[model samples]
Target: MSPDQIVVTVIGLAAIAFIVWFFWLGKRLGVKVAVNSSGYQEAMVLVKGGYTPDLIIVEKGKPVRLNFLRTESAACSEMVMFPDFNKSAHLPEGETVAVELMPNQPGEYEFQCQMGMLRGKLIVED
Candidate 1:
């Protein structure tokens, strides 16, 4: 092959490698958190409106796991929802369902029940 052609091929390969490496690094550094409502131990986070500790602290640019737990004795605990993330899922009674949230920005994101009675916040810190 010609010298110029070989150099071009090398550059192209380097670019592809760089792109893959960048994505891998981003994933590795991403944050992950898990919140379990109805959790036997961590169950029921009580939040009293504006600015509460219901705001869970998490690392910026990471994947968050929000676990919704429900009990058969409660009516509609399974219909919990989060408007901020545009997510709505009904979990079966006496079960745990996990939602994955990947927030790329550093900000406070609010999540609440469809009824708006239950609320929580995800506080991302850089």
Candidate 2:
């Protein structure tokens, strides 16, 4: 291969590696819900490029309140959906929106953006 071709191939390979690491092998931030004075398990999730604490843990059979603060104006981040709980919320830019969930059984659930680009997980424990 020519010198130019080699450089291009290397760059392409690097880009592919970055994408894989970012989307799959990156470090995931997890937050365990805390029971607030209002008696609800709550956690604040920052929304920008993605959910800050993408992994949320809470106890089953309790109310879980996830406060999502959208810091970016990206259209893809406007909405968050919890398919398992059939709950969703519109997150306005520069404002906070609360999405509540009640997990009667201990299991793992998924939450994502409207486009499913940004994703998160909710783990309900016994």
Candidate 3:
């Protein structure tokens, strides 16, 4: 009945809407990167409900660097692991952590959070 209550309700609805829309739209939108002059392909992935550009396509036999930025303070998003690469990094809130990987073969490599709730795939192509 109060203006304050109305504002709070509206904000809550907006947050829910954002979450739904993000998951729905993010699934189809993936970023591709090619090896730059620096000898690596660069891509920025956001860690929220999951990794943005949830799928990344990179050239095989080249290096790719994923710059992961953790915007959420959730504990689950604090750590990212790439089992196939034998690599893992602790992602601090509001900081961008770079994970460089070189794949000599063509295949799909998976990355995820500590809890395995967040998943991402990297497709290596010739």
Candidate 4:
């Protein structure tokens, strides 16, 4: 192969590797919900390119309140959905929307944008 062709091939391979690592093999960000004075678990998540701290930890059988602050106006991120909980909320840009759910069982529940482009997980533990 020509030298220029080899360089281009290597760059293309590198870009593909980066995409794989970023979207699949990368380390995920997580946070543990804090119990507020009212006794409900709460977490504040920033919504931009995706949900910041995309993983949340909470106890089973407790109420969880997630405050999502939408910082971007992306159409794909305009709504957040928790299918397992049958809960969803509209996230307006520059506003904080609260989504509440009660996790009755210990398991992992998925939350995602309306288009499923942005995703997160809620882990409930005994």
After TM-score superposition, the amount by which residue 2's alpha carbon in candidate 3 deviates from its true location, in angstroms, is 38
For model 3, residues 1-126, the per-residue Cα lDDT tens digits are 899999999999999999998866545655789777898899999998889978999998888899999999999999999999999999999999999998898998999999999999998888
Models 1 onward score TM values of 0.53, 0.85, 0.77, 0.93
Q: Which portions of model 3 show Cα errors greater than 4 Å?
A: 1-27
| Predicted structure with the largest TM-score when compared to the true one | 4
Please give, for residues 23-97, the per-residue lDDT of candidate 4 as tens digits.
Answer: 899988679887899889999999999888899999998899999999998899999999999989999999999
RMSD of each predicted structure = 15.9, 1.8, 5.9, 1.1
Q: What is the lDDT of residue 73 in candidate 4?
A: 81
Worst 10 residues of 1 by lDDT: 42-51
Q: Which 10-residue span in candidate 2 carries the lowest summed lDDT? A: 27-36
What tens digits encode model 1's per-residue C-alpha lDDT throughout 44-72? 33223311334566766656665566545
lDDT of 2: 0.93
Alpha carbon lDDT of each predicted model:
0.58, 0.93, 0.90, 0.93
Model 1 accuracy (lDDT, Cα): 0.58
After best superposition, candidate 1 residue 119: deviation in angstroms?
1.0
Cα displacement (angstroms), candidate 2, residue 17, comes to 2.3
